[model samples]
Target: MKAIVSVKRVVDYNVRIQVKPDGSGVVTDGVKMSMNPFDEIAMEEAVRLKEKGKITEIIAVTIGGAKNEETLRTALAFGATKAIHIKDEGEVQPLTAARALAAVFKKEGASLLIAGKQAIDDDANQTGQMVAALLDIAQATFAGKVDVDGNKATVVREVDAGLETLEVDLPAVITADLRLNEPRYLKLPDIMKAKRIPIEATTLADLGVTAAAAVKTVKTVPPPSRSKGVMVKTVDDLVAALKAKGLA
Candidate 1:
């Protein structure tokens, strides 16, 4: 079996985000960038599968600017055999990203494609499903547990109430949830070796697919500021306030 994991470069979750002065997007000045957390889980799972002798190869792919090569190298340090980068300097729509990934999946003849259930920055949970739809293959999203046997795979997904399991044939897509295995940190040796690994680059046009204009951002507005709450010294005061507001 061969596994392909899709990764992304995103602003560090710990950094404070500020809107650009021009109101175009977030101000990236002096902000640190790191690999998406959920994608880390997906890559870790792929590496585990390879370690178990269940998968023959693990490939990492990403779509973004040149700086995204750092994210791909991080994936390589985690145990991926090769990397593919789809160069797109501007923001890419979810549909376009899915389409581009699907093209690469076809070209590489991947047996399984794993990606995060959603990107933390965009919170767009469409890419994995869209890629599965484009390829006309099975998909299991929000997967908390995954087990592969022979040509069949079983996945346990987290639902609102609890968990649900689904079985699918090979050549499927799986989007990992938070409950998946924890991602491993790269050792110094691996990090040094990853820098020497070659990364293949491709353009959107090279895939014979045009980027689909699926969604557009109109404007970004800051969330409303919260007001201070009044302190109630006693139950009587609470009741009085509620009655004044017609809530009691």
Candidate 2:
């Protein structure tokens, strides 16, 4: 069984994001970039499945311009047997990403597909579900645990109410959540090996697929800065301050 894991490049979690001066988008120039954290969890889970003999091959896929290959190489170091880059120069929205991933899933004849529950940059949390819909296959999202037996897979998903367990048939999409597993750190040797790993790159045009119309972003802005807390020496003062702020 082959598993295709989707990875994405985004600003590193530790980097402070700054909106462009013209409200165009977040600044990326000279900022740190890395594989999406959730995608790292997805890759780790896929590698674990392969080690358990549940999957025979693991193909990592990413969509973006030239810089995105760095993310795929990270996936390779994480144990992906192959890497595929779906080149797209323009912004690849959620729907477009889903379409591109679905195309790869079909071409690879993969029995399992895994992706992050959400990318930190957008937090859209829709790509995996959209891919499942496009493929018309079963999907399990926000998965904390996964077990595979034959053509059946068991997933424990974290939901608003609580954890929900699901059993889905093979050829399904599974989205990894934070609690799924801890990703292993890449050593110096693995990082060097990743540089030598060949990544197969192609465009959406070559794949014969066009993504859904993109939703335009009107502007980008940072969250409002938190207000300074007022010092209160007594309970009465605190209550008065809360009432003054209309938050009592």
Candidate 3:
């Protein structure tokens, strides 16, 4: 069975984002970009499954601008057998992305789909679930662990209440959470090797899919700046400060 893993190119989490002066969006002119951390975890899961001989092929897919191929190449360096780039522009909402992914899933006849629980850039946490809904398949979100046996997969999910176990048939969608596993670092050799791997480029129209944004962003702004910290000399001082602020 083939496992299709989806990765998203996002602003590196470590970088401090700056809002555009026009209040249109975050500045990306020269920001550092990398694979979404959660997506990296998803890729790690797929690599582990392939290593266990549970899956035959790993196809990495992404939807974004032309530079998105860089993210796909990173996935290939992490061990994806091949990559697919959906050439798109502008802000792609979760629903649109899900539609494109569903089309690819059908086209590839893949039995398993893995995706990040959420993209750090938007933090909508909806793409994986939306993909599952679009495909009309079983889904396990925020998966901490996944065990595959033949046509079945047992997933341990991270839920607010606690961990939950779910058993789903093949052709399922699994979203990786932060605790799933640590993603391996890409070596220089792997990066060089990834350059040779083929990354097929296509478009949503080519996949017979249409993706229009269901939501719109009117403006983007930075959060309010934090207040200066005050050093307390003693318990009495701390108590006095809290009491003055009515937070004691």
The CA lDDT of each predicted structure is: 0.91, 0.94, 0.94
Better of 1 and 2 by TM-score: 2
lDDT per residue for candidate 3 within 1-248, as digits (tens), equals 89999999999999999999999989887899999999999999999999999998999999999889999999999999989999998678999899999999999999999999999998999988988999999999999999999999999999999999999998999999999999998899999999998889999899998877689999999999998999999999999999999999
Which scores greater on lDDT, model 1 or model 3?
Answer: 3
lDDT of 1 by residue, 41-106 (tens): 999989988888878899899998989999999999999999999999877888988989899999
Error of 3 at 174 (Å): 0.5
- Candidate 2 achieves a global lDDT of 0.94
Task: Provide the clashing-pair count of each candidate structure.
Answer: 0, 0, 0
Candidate 2 Cα errors over 4 Å, as ranges = 239-248
User: Mind giving the per-residue lDDT tens digits that candidate 2 earns over 88-151?
Assistant: 9888889988988888899999988999999999999999999999999999999999998999
lDDT measured at residue 196 in model 2 versus the true structure, 0 to 100: 98
